[model samples]
Every structure is written in C-alpha cells, then in structure tokens.
Target chain A: MYAFEYFAPKNLQEATKAFNSFNDSKWLAGGMTLIPSMKLRMNAPSALIDLSSIEQLKGISIKNNILSIGAMTIHADVANSLDVINSLPALASLASGIGDPQVRNRGTIGGSIANNDPAADYPSAILGLKSKIITSKKEIDAGNFFNGFFSTSLDTDELIVKINFQIPESAIYLKFANPVSRYAIVGIFLSKYHDEVRVAVTGAASCVFRVNELEEGLFHDFCSSVVDKTDYGITNLNDDIHANSEYRRYLIKVMIKKAISILQKK
Target chain B: MRISLTINGNPVSEDVDNRTLLADFIRNTLGLTGTHVGCDTSQCGCCVVHLNGEAIKSCTMLAVAANNSEITTIEGLSNSEDLSAMQESFRRNHALQCGYCTPGVIMSAVDLLKNNPKPTEEEVRDALEGNLCRCTGYHNIIKAILDVSKAG
Candidate 1:
C-alpha cells in the first residue's frame, strides 16, 4: 500500500470536513475490501478517513416496525444482534454467511453496500426489503441507490450513515457461494410485505436486480411451486469461469425454490 | 506517523509508515515474530490476531487503523512459563504438522473459545474456516478445539 495521511474523525461533520480537505481520499470502514485493494495497488488514495470512531454510526435499533442498522455495524454484530435476529432472522442468517468468521468481524454493512460488489449479500437484502439508505446528505431509496458494477449513486464525499429496513411479513435469502472467496455465485433474496412480493437476485449480473416476473408470480401464489414453474430470462445474466449465464439462470430458480421452502417451513 | 496502542497489555507508542500493515508492524517493528504471514492477500488466515477483542486478519488491516486500540497476538496467548489452554489442546491433539499455521490457528481458536466456551464440533469447524491448516488436513485442529471446549 502506498503511504497516505490518516484521519480518525469522531463525527460525520468532522469526517466530511477531512474528506473535503483531501484531494483523493477514501473513507475507511472495516477496510475489508479497500485495504486489500490498496495493497494490490488497485487503489491509491491520498488520505484515509477512518469512521470507526464515530459513536452514532455503530448500533442496531428497532423503531416503528423498522430495523435501522448503523452502517459501521460489522457483519458479526449484525449476525449476533438480538434485535436483528428477533425481527429479521433471514437477515441475520445472511450476515452470518458472509465471507468467514474473521472477515465478518471487521466487514461493515456500510462498506459492503457502499462498494456495491456485484457478489455482495447486503445489496440483495436492501433491494428485496425495499430499504432506505440514510447518508450524510440524504436518504436514498435502496432501489435507486445501486447503479452498476461496483458503483452507487453516492457522491465521492457522501458517507452512508444508516440503513432502514422494513420488517417484512416473510423473507429468506439463499445463495450458492464460491468455495474460496465465499462470494455469492448466484444468490436470491425473496421477501413479502402484505400483498406485495419482491425478488432480488445478486451475483448473476453486473448488479443486484429485481425479477419482476418471479415477483409477479409469487404475488399471485406465494409458494415454492410458483418459483419452480417460473422461467428466468438469461439475456443479460453473468457468464464467468465459475458459472455460465444459463447456469446462473438455473441457480436463480433453485435458490428461489430453496428460499420458498424455508419460508414455507416458517 | 506516530501511533500508540496497547499490545499484549503493554502500551507501546512508535512511529511507522502510514501504509504499514499491522502484521508487519507486529512481526518486524515490534519483533513479535509468532504472527505468521502465509498469504498476504487475506485469503489465508495465517496472520489472524485479536484487535479490540475480535479476531481479524492482521495483514488486511493497516497499522494506523489500530491506533489507540487493544491488540493481542500469538505471543500474548502464553508466557515463557506456561502455554495457553488452546495451545496445550493443540499439542495434546497433535493438531500441527509443519506448525506454519499453528499460531494463527491458536489465536483464532482462543478468540472462539472466549466467545463460546463450549462450541460444538460443527461450530468449531465453522469457526476454523478462516484459519486454514493445509498440513494437518484440519481433523486434529478441530479435535483440539473440541477438546479445549470440553475441558472447559
């Protein structure tokens, strides 16, 4: 990693002030992905503004039937939070299944969603649950937050503060993870709120996307049979060494079916 | 840049390059060579250590990030007079072959036992996912962790 100035800001205002002062700087949260990229010389920031010290950016709270998670909250904390487990067990399970134990200890929800890795787990949850991303400047709907591969609508200096997830009536996240990296090869998050159903698929494309056809099918009949009968289009799905586009399409169906099975058991 | 942190219960303040990795700072600067670095890409867990009571990949974290934090490395697990329970369990189970991955595996196991004093075999296996031991095939390591959990 190249030498760079470091700043540990205690609050959002201080962080943004330091961010604006530096010509090229990156906000450090968990440093799970950014640090490694820096080590490989893929990213060379002039400064690093560490946000771990901010007290307001680290917590889990449930209010008014919504689960508001601090962006700096690590995966392990999310996985172990009683509030999260009680309100959204599927989200807890998703947190527990990211990377490995060590990575989960340091990887933050904010960093994960901010990087917007195509294979990341949180994007699927945010999109499937129709959550709102609260940033330092404004609250962006999860649907409009993610743009494309490794990209979001966030400005360079904008910092994510918290994520507000609605308590869904029922939801489940299922994924086929890569053996080594543990990144989702083809993951699907299925969620239902009242009469509406949403299906978000990750790792099978350049970004986490919704499957309208499957969502429509499940809205009519919320069952595993509906998922089994639905046909997923492979027109723009990902094709890599791990899985071809057709294989990803197949995995999407299988994961949705698995999620439905889990939902049915509950 | 100058940074200060608690390492193994000792307060140490030093000047280091801003880009210095925590693994290198511990191994080279502080002269605590027990923390091994097998794969610097953070894929292998040979450099795992406790930062503020949680197990994290030392190689993946910058030394500056650990400023004012508490860190526990493999050396902190045991003194010259005695071995930690997890180390003894590994010894009793013959969990190591080349011993290259022993320190990290022990550090990770110690943190696991701290969080869960009695983890099941499946839990032990899951916790050891980050610490890869290519030499022993992980049977003995898993056994060692289970033994320590049972002893407690």
Candidate 2:
C-alpha cells in the first residue's frame, strides 16, 4: 500500500479526536475494500485512524420494535447474534450470505454501508426495512443516506455510530450471488410494514433503489400473483461482465418473487 | 510500531512497520508461513486466521490493529504430539492436494465448528465459500470438514 501513519485509538472519543485533527485521514473499518484500493494505488490516505479498537462500534440490540446495531459490527456477529436472529432473521440471513466465511468475519456493517457498493447486500436491507443511519452527529433516514454508487451523505469527519431498523411484520432477502466475489448480481429485499409493502432492489442499478411499481403491486396483492403479471423492464439496471442489464432486470423480478414467496410461507 | 497480541496460546510482541498487513506480519516477521496469501484483494480466504477465535481475512487487517487480540494460525492447530481433529480429517479425506489453500480452509473450518459444532452439508459449503481451491474442487474439503465435525 501507500505510506501512511496508522493510529490505533483505544476508544471512540480518542479516535474522533485523532480523526478531527487530520485533514485527509480515513477511518479504517475492516479494510475489505480500502486495502485493495490502496494496494492498487487508487487511494493513498496520509493517515489512517483505525476504528477497530473502539468497543462502542461493535454490538447488536433490540428494544421494543427497533433493532439497533453498532456500525463496526461484523457480518459474522450479525449472523450469529441471537438478538438479530430473533428480531430480524432476514437481516441475519443477508449477513450470512455476504461474501464468504472470512469476509463475513472481517467485513463490518459500517464499512459495507459507508462504501455503498451497488452490489452490496446491506444497502438493500437498509432501504427495504427503512432503517436509520445513526452517525456521530445526526440520524439520517436510509433513503437520504445513500447518494449514488460508492457515495453517501456522510461527511468525512462523521462516524457511523449505529443503525436502527423498524421491525417489519414480515421480511425476506433474495440475491443471486456472484460466483467469484459472492457479491449480489441482483438482490431484492421485500418487507411488509403495517399497510405498506416496500421493495428494494440492489446490484441491478447504480445504487440500491426502491421499486415503486413492484411495491405498489405487492401492496395491492401481497402475493406472487401480482408479480406474475407485472412487467419490470431492464431499462436502468447495471450491466457488467457477470451479467447484462437484461439479466439483472430478470433476476430482480425473480428475486422479488422469491422473497415474497418466502415471506408468505412464514 | 510495536504490536502485542496472543498467538497460538503464547504472548507475542513485535515491532512492525506502519504499512505491514496482519497476514504479512504473521508470515514474515513471526515466520508463521502456514497462513498463505492467495488474492491480496480479500476476495480469497487463503490468508484466513482466527482473530479472537473468529475466522477473518488477515490480508485486510492491519498488524497494529490486531494488538491485544488473540490470533490462531494453522501452525497452532496441531499440538506437538498429535494432529487436530480437523487436520486428521483433512489428511484422511485428502482434502488438500497442492496444500496452498489448506491453512485457510482449516482455519475457517475451525471457526465454523466453534460456532456450529454440527453444520449441515450446505452450511459447510457456505462456510467454505470464501476459501478457493483450484485443486480437488471443494467436494473433498467439505467432506473433510463434515467428517471431522461428525467424529469430533
């Protein structure tokens, strides 16, 4: 990688103090994406503030109808947490399906959400469940948190403290995983919260986006019957070496259908 | 940078460069070559190791950050006398051929069994998804992990 001074702070306050003192320093969370980018010479931060030591960033808890997870919580923690499994089993399943065993063990929820890769699985779960991104400064809604590909509304100095999701009556996540990276080729997260049915589609677009048409159809029927007749064209989907835009669009519908079917079965 | 941690049930202290990755530190500085490096991009789990008893890609972690944590490498799996149950299973089932990917696979399997002692075939496959083996495909590796779990 590039030349950089690494600081391992013992707590969040110290980490934030060190982070705010620097101009071009980056917080190192998991480093699944950042380390590779650095190895390729794409980014060379002058300093790195390692947040892995901050204990406040790792945990999961559920209170009332809200499921709260610390930002630095790893996929393995989420996958194994009884609290997560009891509150939002779909989220746990999504975490378990991310990358592989090693990645799940190292990759942090904060890192995944902050990077906001279009093919990432957490964005779909956030968008579908209408979660809130609680940062050091403000609590931003999931809709406003994501801006575009590898982009978010988070400021450079801001640190993601925790994530909160409303407990939906029923939810399911379905993704066609890439054979190599295990990233989602087309992931769909469907949730029924009270009277509204929300559908979030990732991996097939520039970013995880809400499918209003599918949501409306699902809200009306809440079954696979409406999905059979609905037509979701591959107009704005992403095309790459793994899959073309048309295939992603097809997978989106297929995954949504699968998610709804799974939800109905439960 | 001076980093201190417990490795293979022993306390270790080493002064490392700021840019040194955990995988490099383990293999080069400590001379624990059992942890291999496959794809430095974190896509492959050839450098998998147990950080505080949980399997993680050592390539993506900084050596300095691993201070005060408990790390277990493949060399630590077997005692001075006998092989670990997982290692015996790998040997019995011929889970490894070139053996480049053996360390990571075994580390992952160790973590998998620690969490779920009796994982199903599909669960074993899912657990080993991060580990890539061009040799022997993955059928034998999965079978080895399953056999070990069943016997252990």
Candidate 3:
C-alpha cells in the first residue's frame, strides 16, 4: 500500500469534508476490499477517510415494516441480530454465509454494496427485496442504485447512511458458492410480496440482475414447477473459469428452484 | 501517524506509517511474533487477532485503524506459567504438525467457543474455514476443538 493520509472521522460531516478536500480520497468502510486492493497495488488513493468512528452509521433497526440496517454494520452483527433473524431470516442467513466468520467480523454491508463487486451477495438481496438505499443525500431504490459491473449510481462524495428493506411475505437466498473464495458462482435471491414476485441473480453476470421470465412465471403461479418450466437464456451471462455462461444459466434455474422450495416450506 | 491501543492488557503507543498492516505492527513494531502472517492476501487466517473482542484478519486491517481499540494476540491467550485451555486441548489432541497455523487456528477457535460454547463438529469446521491447516488434514484440529467444547 502506498503512503496516504488517514483520517478517522467521528461524524458524517467530517468525513464528507475530508473526502471533498482530498485529491484522490476514498471512504474507508470496513476496508475488507479497499485495503486488500491497496495492498495489491490495484488502488492507490491519496487519502483514506475511515468511517469506522462514525457512530451514526452503525446499527440495525425495524420500523414502519421496513428493516433498516446501518451502512457500517458488520456482516457478523447482521448475521446474528435477533431483529434481523426474526423479521428476515433470509437476510440474516445471507449475511452469515458471506465468506467466513473472520470476514464477516470485519466486512460491512455498506462497503459491500458500495464496492459493487459483481460476485457480492448484498446486491442480490438489495434487488430481490427491493430495498431502499438511504444515502447522505437521498434515498435511491435498490433497483436504480446498481448501474453496472463494479459500478453504482452513488457519487464520490455521497455516503450511504443505511438501507431500508421491506419485509417480504416470503423470501430466500441460495447461492452456489466458490469453495476457495466463497464468492457466489451463481447466487439467486427470490422474494414474494403478495402477488409481486422478484428474482435477483448475482455472480452469473457483470452485475446483479433480475430474471423477468422466472419472475413472471412465479408471479403467475408461485411454485417450483413454474420456475422449472422457465428457460433462462444464456445471453449476456458471465462466463468465467468457475462456470461457463451455459452452466450459469442452468445454475440460475436450480438456485431459483431451491429458493422457491425453501420459501414454500417456510 | 501516532496511534495508541491496549494490546494483551498493556497500554502501548507507537508511531507507524499510514499503510502499516496490523499484523506487521504486532509482529514487527511491537515484537509480538506469536501472530504469524502466512498469506497476506487476507484469504489465510494466520494473522487472526481479537480486535474489540472480534476475530479479524490483522493483515487486512491497517494498524492506524486499530488505534484506540483493544487487541488480543496469541501471546495474550496464555501467561508464562501455563497455556490456555484451547492451546492445551490442541497439544493433547496432537492437532499441530508444523505449528505454523496453530496460533491463528487456536485464536479463531477460542473466539468461536466464546460465541458458541458447545459448537458441534460441523459448526466448528464451518467456523474454521477462514483458518487454513495443510499438515494435519484438519481431523485432529476439529477433534481438538470438539474436545475443548466437551470438556467445558
């Protein structure tokens, strides 16, 4: 890592100030991805505005039928939160399955979505549950937040405060995780709110995306049979060493089936 | 930058580079060699340490970020007189071969047991995913953690 000025801001205002004043500054959330990238010399920022000290950006709460999670809340905390587990066990389970215990202990939900790694799990949850991303400036719907692979609609100075997820009637996340890195080979999150059905797939594309065919099939008839009948085309899917595009398309159907089966039993 | 923290119950202060990793600060600056750095890519858990009571990979964290926080390394697990229960269990179960990954494995296991006192074998295995052990094939290490849980 290159030598840089580090500032641990106690509040969002100070963080924003540091970010605006610095030449090439980056907001350090959990530093799980940023530090590693810096160490690898892939990213070299002039200043690091650490947000760990900002008390306002750390918590989990539920109000108005929305599950609000602070941006800086570590994955371990989200995984073990009683409120999250009770209100949305699928989200808790998703947090718990990210990486390992050590990774969960340090990685934050905000950092995960901010980085917007194509293989990350949070984007799938955000899109599938139709969460609202509450930033320092405005609340962006999860559908509109993600732009493309490793990209988001967030401005450089715009800090994500928290994310608000509406509790779905039934939702579940299933992923075919890479054994070594534990990133998803093809992860799918399926959620049903009354007659509305949403299917978000991650790790099998350049960005987290929704499968309209499966969503429409499930919307018409919410069952494993409906998902099994749908054919998810391999066009525009990610083809990597872990899995080819055709294999990813197949896994998407399998994962959606698994999630539907799990939701059906719930 | 100058930073201060409580390490192994001792209050210490040091000046380090802004990019200094916590593992390097612990092993090089502080001379606490018990915390090993097997792989610096953050995949290997050889540098696992307790930061504010949570087991995190020290290599992935900047030393300055840990300022004002409470850290517990492998050396803090035991005094000069005797070894910690988890360490003792590893010794009794022959869970170590070259001992390169033992300190981190023990540190991770101790944290797991702290959270879930009586974790099952599968649970222990799942928790140990971050900590890699090539020599023992993980059979004895899993048994050692289970033995410690059963003994408690």
Candidate 4:
C-alpha cells in the first residue's frame, strides 16, 4: 500500500476543507473498498479524508413517506434496521447479502454507490427504486448519478450526504453471487409501484441499468411467463472470470423467473 | 499520524504511518500477534476483530481510520485462567487442526452471538462465511458456535 497522509474530519465543513488542501485526496467513507484497492495498488491517492467521524452522514430514517438513509450508513445497520425492514424489506435483504458479515459491518452505502462497481448491489437499489442521491451540494437523480462502470456524475471532492429511496408498493432483489467475493454476477432488482414497474439489472452490463422492455412488460402483465422477453443482444455486457457474457444474459432470465415467482408468493 | 484507541481494556495512543493497517498496528506495533493476517486482501477472516463492538476486517481498515474506536483482539477475549465461552466451545468441539483461522473464527463467532444469541445451524454457517477454515471443513466450528448459542 502507498504511504499517504490521512485526516479524519469531524464535520462536513471540515471534510471539505481537508479535501481542498490535498491535491489528490480521496474521501474515505467506510474504507472497505478504497483501502483494499490501495493495498492492491489499483488506487494511489496522495491523501485520504476519512469521513467516518462525520456525524451528519450516518443514519436511517423514514420521513415524508421516503426512506432517507445517510450515506455513511453501513450495510449491517441497514440489514438490521427496523425502519428499513418495515419500509423497504427488499433493500434490507440486498444489504444483508453483501460481501460477508465483516464487510457489511464496515462497507457503507455512500461508498458503494460512489464507487459504482458494476457488480455492486446498492446501485441496483438506487436505480430500481428511483432513489435520489443527495450530495453535499445538490440532489441528483439516480439516473443521472451513475455514469457507467466505476464512474459517477459526482464531482471530484463533492461528497454524497444521503440517499432518498422511493418507497415501492412491493419489490424483490435476486442475485447470482460469486461464491468467493459475493459480488453479484447478475443481480436483478424488481420494484412495482401503484402504476409503474421498475426493473434494474446489475453485473450483466457495464452499468446498472433499468430494463425498460422488462419494466414495460411487467407493468402490463406482472408475471413470470413473459419476464424473459429481454433485449440481451446489446453489444456491451459485463463479464469477468466468474461468468461469460452469454451466461450472464441467460442468468438474467433465470433470475427474473425466480424473482417474479418470489414476488407472487409474497 | 497519531492514533489513539482502547484495545483489550487498555488505552494506547501512538504515532503511526498514514497507510498502516489496523491488523499491522495490532500485531506489530502493540505486539498482539493473535490477530492473524492470512490474506491482506480482506478475503480471509483471519484478520477479523471487534471495532466498536462490531466485527470488521482489520486488514481493510487503516489504523488512523480506527481513530478513537474501541478494539478487541483474540488476546482480549480472556486470560489464561479462563477461556471465553466460545473458546471453550471450540475446544469441546475440536474445532481446529491447523488453528490458523481459529482466532478470527472465534472472534467472528463471538460477534455473531453478541448480536444474535441463539443462531440455527444455517445461520451459524452464514455468519462464518467470511472466516475460511481449510481444516475441519467448518463442521466442528459450526457445531461449536451452535452449541454456545444453544447454551445461552
């Protein structure tokens, strides 16, 4: 790991101030991904501004019919929070299925969404529920927040404050996880509102994207029989050693069938 | 950088490199070798420890990130005169052969029980997913954790 300067800022103001001072500093949320990336030399920031001490960015609450989760809220907290379970149980289930017990304890929502790894689970939740990424400066729509694989519209040094998740009438998240890393090989998050349905697919593409065709079909019929009607012939799809593009596209159908079955059972 | 934290019921503040990991600080700086670093990439649970009473991968957390948090290593669990209930359970179940992952497995199990007292067999297995046990094939480890949960 590269030896870099570190600072733990107490508040948002202090954190921003620290970021401005360092030329190439990274905002540290949970350090679950950043630290590991640093150890592997995949990332080499000159300095780090640890945001764990920022009190304003750590919580979960439901107000005004929206589930507002502070960005620094860790996965374990989300998994165990009564409010999350009561309001968005599918989101909680996704959180509980992340990496492992220890990783969930340290990995935060803000970091996950900010890094925007293609296989990350939070991005699907954000895009599927049509959540809003509340930054330190402004509110960005989930569609605009994610740019592509490991990319985001977040400005450099602009920190995410919280995320406001739209409460769906009912939703389900299903993932074919890599056994070792537990990252989603092809995760599908299906959310149904009163009049609209949202289907978000992760790990199968270069970005977490909503399947408009699937959503349209589900909006009309809302059943497993036709959930397989997807346009997987798209030129670009994400594939790693764990799965090939062909398998991922096929698994999408399998997962959606399983997801629709589970949703009906509920 | 200067970091201060309470470990094993003792408070210690020391100067450390900005990039030093919590696992290195515990093992090399404080001479607490009980926390093993089987895989520095955070895949292995050999570096598991309690950070603010929650189990976390110490290898993935910087020492400075720990800051003022409270940490509990395997050494902090009990003294020579006494073994923790989880440890005693592991001994009774013969949960280890190589014993490389035992410290982390014990720490992770203790954290699991602290949160969920009576875990089923499947729950115990799920909780230990982070801790890789090449020996015993994790049958006895799960048995050990389940036995403690039942006793509690």
Candidate 5:
C-alpha cells in the first residue's frame, strides 16, 4: 500500500470536512474490499478517512414498517439483529448468506452497496425491497442507485448515511454461490407487496438488475405459477471461468423459480 | 499515524505509516504473530480477529480505523490454566494438520458459538464457509466446533 494520511474523525462533520479537503481521499468503511485493493496496488489514495470511529454510522432501527439501517452497519449485525430477523427475515437471511463468518462480521452494508460489486448479494435485496439510500446530499431510490459495472450514482464528495427499506408482505433471496469465492454466481430476490412485486437479479449481469418479465408476471398474478410460466431472455449477463454466460442465464431462471417457490411455501 | 487500541486484553499505542494494516499492527508492531496474513485480501480469513467481539479479517482493516476499538486475537482465547473450549476441541478432534489455518478457524468458531451456540452441523459448516482450509475436508473441524458447543 502506498503512503497516505489517516484521519479518524469522531463525528460526521469533521470527517466530511477532511474528506472534502483531501485530494484523492477514500472513505474507509469496513475495508473488506478497499484494503485488499490497496495492498494489491489496484488503488492508490492520498488520504484515508476512517468512518469506523464515527459513532453515527453504526446501527439498525425499525419503525412504521420501515427498517432504517446505518450505512456502516456490518453484515454480521444485520444477520444477527433481532429487529432485522423478526421484521425482515429475508433481509436477515440474505445478510447471513454473504461471504463467510469473518467477512460478514467486518463487511459493512454501506461499503458493499457503495462499491456495487456485480456479484454482491445485497443489491438484489435492495432493488427488490425498494430500499432508499439516504446520503449526506440526498436520498436516492434503489432503482436509480446502481449505474453499471462497479459504478453507482454517488458522487465523490457524498457519503451514504443510512438505507431504509419498507417491509414487504413477503420476500425471499435465493443465491447460487460460487464455491471458491463464495460470491453469488446468480441470485434472485422476490419481493411481494400490496399490488406490486419486484424481482431483482444479481451476479448474472454487469450490475444487479430487475427482471421486468418476471415482475410483469407477478404483477398480473402474484403466484409461483405466474413466474414459472414467465420467460427471461439471456441477452447480456456475466460470463467467466466459474460459469459461462449461458449457464449464468440458466442459473438466474433457476434461482428465480427457487425464490418464488420458497416465498410461496412461506 | 499514531493508533491505539486494546488488543487481546492489552492496551497498546504505536506510531505507524498510514498504509499499515490492522493485521500488521497486531503482528509486527505488537509482536503478536498468531494472526497470520494469508491473501492480504478479505478473501482469506487467516488474519481474522475479533473487533468489538465480532470476527473480521484483520488484513482488510486499516490500523488507524481500529484505534480505541477492542480486539481479541486467537492468542487471547486461552490461558496457562487450560486452552479455551474451542482450542481444546480442535486438538482433541484433530481439526488441523498443518496448523496454519487453525488460529483463524478457532477465531471464527469462537465467534460462531458466541452468537449461535446451538448450531446444527449444517449451520457450523455454513459459518465456516468464509475461512478456507485446503488440508482438511472440514469434517473434523465441523465436528470440533459442534463438540465444543455441545459440551458448553
């Protein structure tokens, strides 16, 4: 890793000031991804603004059918939190399925969403649950959050404060994890709400995306039979040594079917 | 950069370069070599340590970020009286052969049990999915964690 100045601000104001003044400064959330990228010389920043010490960026709160999670909330916290598990079991289950125990404990929801890794599991839930990301600047809808590849709509000076999710009637996240990396090769999130249903797919494309066809089918008939009869074209999904684009396309269908089946059984 | 944290029940302060990782701070600066760095990426859990009583890959964390945080490495799990329950289970069940991945495995196991003490065998396997081991097929390690949980 290259030499850089490190600043640990106790409050968000001080952190935001340091972040704005420092050239090429990167906010250190959980370091699950950034630290490794730095060690591999894949990234070089002039300064590191540590958000871990900033007390405001850590917790989970639920009220009025809305779950508000601090951006820095760790995966383990979400997986183990009673409020999350009881109110939003699908989200809790999704958090429990991320990486391994160690990764879950340290990796932050904010970091994962901010990085917007295509193979990440959180985006599927965020998109399917119609979550709202509250940043220092403005709130962004989950639909417009992800840009493409590893990109997002966030600007350089902005910091994500919290992510809010409205509790759906029923939701399930199904993932086919790559055995080696533990990343989702293909995952689907099925969220059923009043008169609306969202089907989001991850690990099958350059970014997590919603399956409009499946969404339409569920909109017409909110049942497994509806999704089972739906067709999703495999136009431009991800392809790698782990699985080919065709295989990933197949896995996406399978995951969507499985997620719907699970949701139906629930 | 100057960073201070309570590690393995000991408070230590050190001046370091901003690029120093929490893994290096624990191993090189504090001279606690038990925490090994495998991939230096979050991909490997060999450098896993407890930050505020939760297991996390130390290699991925910056040293300055851990300042004022309480950390527990594998070294802090036992005493002269006897090894911790998880450590003893690992030995009795032969959970490790080369022993390079034991510290991390034990750290993760302690964390798993702390949260879900009565985990089923499948849950145990699921909990260890992040910490990779090439030598063992994870049969004995899974058994070790279950045994400790059962005993406790």
Candidate 6:
C-alpha cells in the first residue's frame, strides 16, 4: 500500500468537509475490504477519511416498526445484538454467517453494501427487505440505490449514514457459499410481507436482483414447491472459476427451494 | 503519523507511515515477530489479533486505523515463557505439523472460547474458518479447542 494522508473526523460534518478537500480520498468504514484492496494495488487513494470515531454512525435500533442500523456498525455487533435477534432473527443469522469471526468483528454493513460485491450477503437482504439507504446527502430506496456491478447510485462525495428496514412478517436468507472465501455462489433471500412476497438473488448476476417470477409464484403459493413453477432469469451471471454461469443458474433454483423449505418450517 | 495504543497490556506510541499495516507495526516496528504474515491478502488469518478485544485480520487493518486501540497478539497471550491455556491444548493435542500458523490459530482459538466457552463441535469449526492450517487438516485443532472448553 502506498503512503497516503489519513484523517479521523469527529462527526459527519467534519468527515464530509475532510472528504471534499481531497479529490481522491475514500471513507474508511471497517476497512475490511478497502485496506485489502489497497494492499493488492487494486485501489489507491490520496487520503482516507476514517469514520470509526463518529458517534452518530454506530449502532442498531428499533423504533416504530423500523429497524435502523447505523452505517459504521460492525457485522459482529449486528450478529450479537439483542435488538436484532428479537426483531429479525434471520437477518441476525445472515450477519453471523458472513466471512469468519475475525472478518465479522471488523466488517461493517455500510462497507459491504457500498462495495456491492455481487456475491455479498447484505445486498440480498437489503433488496429483499427493500431497506432504505440513508446517505449523508439523502435517503434512497433500495431498488434505486443499486445500479449494476460494483456501481451504486451514490455520488463520490456521498457517505452512507444508516440503513433502514421494515420488520418483515417473515424473512430467510439461504446461501451456497464458495468453499474458501465463503462468498455466496448462489444466495436466495425470501421475504414475506403482508401484501406481497419478495425473492432476491445474489451471486447469480452482476448485482443483486429480485426474481419477479419467483416472487409471483411465492405470492400465489408461498411454499417450497413454488420454485418449481417459477422461471427465474439466468442471463449475465457473475460467473467465475468457483462456479460457472450454468451451474449458478441451476443453484438458484436449488437455493430457492432450500430457503422456502426452511422458511416454511418456521 | 504517530499513534498511541496498548499491546498485551502495555502502552506504546510510535510514528509510522500511513501505509503501515497493524501487522507490520507489531512485527516489524515493535519486534513482536510472533504474529506471522502467511497470506497478506487477508484470506489466511495468520495475522489475526485482538483489536479492542475482538479478533480481526491485522494485515488488512492500517496501523493508524488501530490508533488508540488495545491490541492482543500471540506474544500478548503469555508474559513469561509459559504458554497460555489454548496454546497448551494445541501442544497436548498435537494440533500442528510445521507450526507456521500456530500463533494465529492459537490466538483465534482463545478468542472463540472467550466469546463462547462451550461451543459445539460445528460452532468451533465455524469460528476458525478464517485461520487456515495446511498441515493439521483441522481435526485435532477442533479437538484441542473442545478440550479447553471441556476442561472448564
């Protein structure tokens, strides 16, 4: 990693002020991803605005049926939170399974979603539950927040403050993970609301996406067998040596069945 | 930049380049060579250390980011030549062959027991997924961790 300026701001206003002065700076969330990227020379920045010390961007809270998690909250904190376990156990379970214990100790939800790796576990939850991303600038719907690939609707200067979710009636996330990295080979997040059902898929494409067919089928039947009748999209998958596109497409149906089965048992 | 932090219960302050990883600061600057750097890419947890009481990959975390933080490395696990409880279990269970990944594996095992003193066999394996040992195949390592948990 090349030498660069480091700034630890006290608050949001100070952090943004520091960011604006440096044309090529990145926000240091957990640095679970960014620091590794720097060491690999995949990224180099003029400076890093550390967000760890900011009080406002660190916690999990439940209020008025909305579960709000501050952006800088680490994965381990979320996984062990009594608030999360009581409100949404599936989400807590998903948090517990990300990377490993060490990775979870330092990795943050803001960093994960902002990076938006196609195989990441958080985006599937974000999209499936339709969480709102509250940025330093404005609040954006989960549907509009993700663009494609590693891209997001966020401007360079925009910093994510917190993520907001409505406590679903029931939600479950199932992932077929890579043996080594533990990244999702194919993940299915099934969320059932009062009026409609959502089916989100990750690692099957360039970005996390909702399967309208699967969603519709589940809406009608809301059972494990719904995967049989649902015709999910399989084009433009984020395929690699770990798993090919054809294999990934097949795993989608397999995971959906598994997820629905587990959710049904609940 | 100069940062202040405590390692193994002692306070230390040092001036370093911003590019310095926490692993380098411990191994290179402080001469605490116990923490190994097997895969600097963060896939291997050779550099796992406790940052403010939570284990994290030190090679991937900037030293500056760990400023004002409490760190516990392999050396920190014991003050004298005596091995810690987890280290003793690893030795009694014959959990290593090359011993290259010992410091990290021991550090990670201790962390697991601290958080969950009596983890199930599956839970023990899940906790140590990041720390890889090419030699042991992880059977005896799992046994070693469960041994400590059972002893208590």
**What does DockQ come to for candidate 1?**
0.87
Give lDDT: candidate 5, residue A196.
85
The two-chain DockQ for each candidate, comma-separated, is: 0.87, 0.83, 0.90, 0.89, 0.83, 0.91
Q: What is the lDDT of candidate 2?
A: 0.88
Candidate 5 lDDT by residue in tens digits, B1-152: 67788987888888987777888988998999999988776766788899999888888877777878999998999856799889999999999998888899899899889888899998898888878787888999999999999998
CA RMSD of each candidate after superposition: 1.1, 1.7, 1.0, 1.2, 1.7, 1.2
Report the lDDT of model 5 for residue B151: 91
Residue A21 accuracy (lDDT) in model 4: 93
Judging by lDDT against the true structure, name the best candidate. 3
User: After TM-score superposition, what is the CA distance of residue B112 in candidate 6 from its true location, in Å?
Assistant: 0.4
lDDT of 4 by residue, A62-163 (tens): 988799999999999999999999999999999999999999999999999999999999999999996899999999998899998799999998999999
User: What TM-scores do the predictions have?
Assistant: 0.98, 0.95, 0.98, 0.98, 0.95, 0.98
Interface RMSD of 4: 0.8
Clashing pairs in 2: none
Residue-wise lDDT of candidate 5 within A1-266, one digit each (tens)?
Answer: 88888887888889989998877998888777888788888989998888877778889999899999999999988988999999889999999888888778778999999999999999888899979999988999999999999999999878999999999998988889988777899888889888788999899889999988879777777666765576656588777888999898777776777777777787
Instruction: Give the C-alpha lDDT of model 5.
Output: 0.87
Off by over 4 Å in 2: A228-234
lDDT of 4 by residue, B40-72 (tens): 888889999999899999999999888889999
Tens-digit per-residue lDDT, B1-152, candidate 2: 88899999999999998888999999999999999999887867899999988899899888888989999999898768799999989999999999998999999899989988999999898888888899998999999999988887
True-contact fraction per candidate equals 0.87, 0.92, 0.87, 0.95, 0.97, 1.00
User: Comparing candidate 1 with candidate 6, which one achieves the higher DockQ?
Assistant: 6
lDDT of 5 at A173: 84
Worst 10 residues of 5 chain B by lDDT: B37-46
